[model samples]
Target: MSAHRSLSWLFTLGLLATLPVAFAGGIRGTGDLGLVIERTTGSVRILETSGNRFLARVEGLGDLSHASVVYSRDQRYAYVFGRDGGLTRVDMLEARVDRRVVQAGNSIGGAISQDGSLVAVSNYEPGGVRVFDAATLEPVADLPATFGDGRRSKVVGLVDAPGNRFVFSLWEAGEIRVADLSDRANIVVTRYEGIGVNPYDALVTPDGRYYIAGLFGEPGLAVLDLWHPGEGVRRILSDYGPGDEPLPVYKMPHLEGWAVAGGRAFVPAVGAHELLVVDLESWDPVARIPLQGQPVFAIARPDGRHVWVNFALPDNDRVQVIDTESLAVVSELEPGPGVLHMEFEPRGEEVWLSVRDENRVLVYDTDSLAVLTELEAATPSGIFFTARAHRTGL
Candidate 1:
């Protein structure tokens, strides 16, 4: 070959080596990515919130009618829990399901441990909690919800606590249990019975110090202080039930939706059109603000300046925003029908809401209360952002 041709070939080879590095930089980060669950389609739509655009749709996730998601600490992977017991680990960066396994017959939801090394699922069919290795989706331990009569009770409200412990509630047995998984070889399980009748759902305070369970068979709430587990569980708001002739409940209230702002907790009242405000110091009722219908979710913005609430059935089309300082509803918006869920941006400047009936997700400006963007979706139910990876109970 000529000397000129040899030099040109070497130059082309050098350029090829630099091309891969340049292309890798274009790959987006998972911090700005999120997932929207499509209940009817059994799929999830991966989204890029920075540009407010749809990225990809991952299908074949079984029975997402009651799906919930928890993110890995790196924010690159999302663990999706489907109602059909399908536990899927999704790679947000790749926009695909990385690994999946069906661990039980029916699963309610799950949580990622504080260290993000384990994922635990609460089941209703077999009545037990299953813990899995976060990276490989392999079973690590199984703790059954067996009660007095040698029968397994349905589990609910499974949440991850600070010390790599898992806290959950027993629906049928009216009990709360804590499973300490810090040491795999020596697992410790603690049970607190007679917590409340039909403890429907629960939530751990952002500080991870308190685990509060909302009772369904009655009106009160069950509170447990993780800092002092020896005190057992105590009842709060026992006499706060709506008196005789209470309205029919359209849907159960989500305890995870409880908003803790300004030393108080704002929660939806079941079987009533009201939002109850509780003083966190005393865990007593401070005030009750009337609403449009049976309340479902009462969520607060990141700054805690305002709270956004949605209803069920007849009032499902409306969303009300309450001013935290005054503890009153300042704005009411009719954002179409079937408003299923709401998620605030990491900075609390914008919020995303899933309008299932309209098949769209609406993003609203927190300051102006105006619609900023509306993207098409397929029966979207839950809008989970990767920011949840850093939070304690989310």
Candidate 2:
């Protein structure tokens, strides 16, 4: 071959290699994508935040009245857990359900394993946790939350922990169980008794070091050090409840929205209009910032500069932002009625909220607190983003 001809052939191969990257540059990945659940219709709308537009609307999801979602490691698929025990695997790119199964009578929520190889659901009716293969949606193990003379307890606070393990709380049993699945063939579960009564929900720290369960039957929270599991569970904020007769709780606070900013944890006070701030170093209550109503979700920005909180009924229409450093309500907004949930952008530039009563989803600029966009939906609730796939607990 001629020297010039050989040089031209080499240049052609280099251009071909660059073509794929150039083409991909025009296509946005799933990182900028998210979904909003239409609770009334049992459907979800795939949203792309970069353009503030809806990509597709998928329907026929069962019983999303209290639905929650978790994403695969690649963020290409989402596992939706519904109230009617329906586990639906959704393909975000195709905007369709990849797989669906009714695994139990009733299920609260679910989590993906740390390694993203397994998905686990916590059931309320049958009272157990079921682990499934993430890729195939096939059952890998069945863990019944049985305790005290064959009574099955409802499982709550299901979270993926480090080391390919699952940690959950047993409602009726008043216990916490850590299921180790490091070896698929041999599953080991360590159980802790007396982990606080009626542990409704729980959260794990970002570092995957602590698992805390919020108690409904008591005033305090139950904390377990995953690093020191043999140390068992300890009680925190045991006397944080009200001194006088507490007001009626409109809705149970979601601990999944617990925020840790600047080494402090901001959590909702049960049955009270307050945001309890705790020193993460000591796991002790530092201060309680009074709120407008019972706080439902107290979430922090990614930068830890601020916390945005939504309240329960009668105050549900309002959202208050708290300055993490100042420890005060910085700003407030009334997006609409029935503000079910809030999700921040991956970098915390914007926040998306589901307004059920108005049948809309509102996006707001975090810095300016201005309405960026409004989307139409039936009755949206949980707003989940692909960013959660990288977080420890959602």
Best candidate, TM-score:
1
Per-residue C-alpha lDDT of model 2 across residues 251-344, encoded as one tens digit per residue: 9888873488898888888887888898878887889998898888888988989999998999999999999988999899999899999999
Per-residue accuracy of model 1 over 275-367 as CA lDDT, tens digit each = 888887888799999888888888889998999999999999999999989988999999999999999988899999999999999999989
Taken over the whole model, the C-alpha lDDT of each candidate is: 0.89, 0.90
**Best by lDDT, which number?**
2
The Cα error of candidate 2 at residue 58, in Å, is 0.8
Enumerate clash totals for all models, in the order shown: 0, 0
What lDDT score is found at residue 370 in candidate 2? 95
Which runs in model 2 stand beyond 4 Å of their true positions?
1-28
Q: After superposition, how far is residue 141 of candidate 1 from its true place, in Å?
A: 0.6
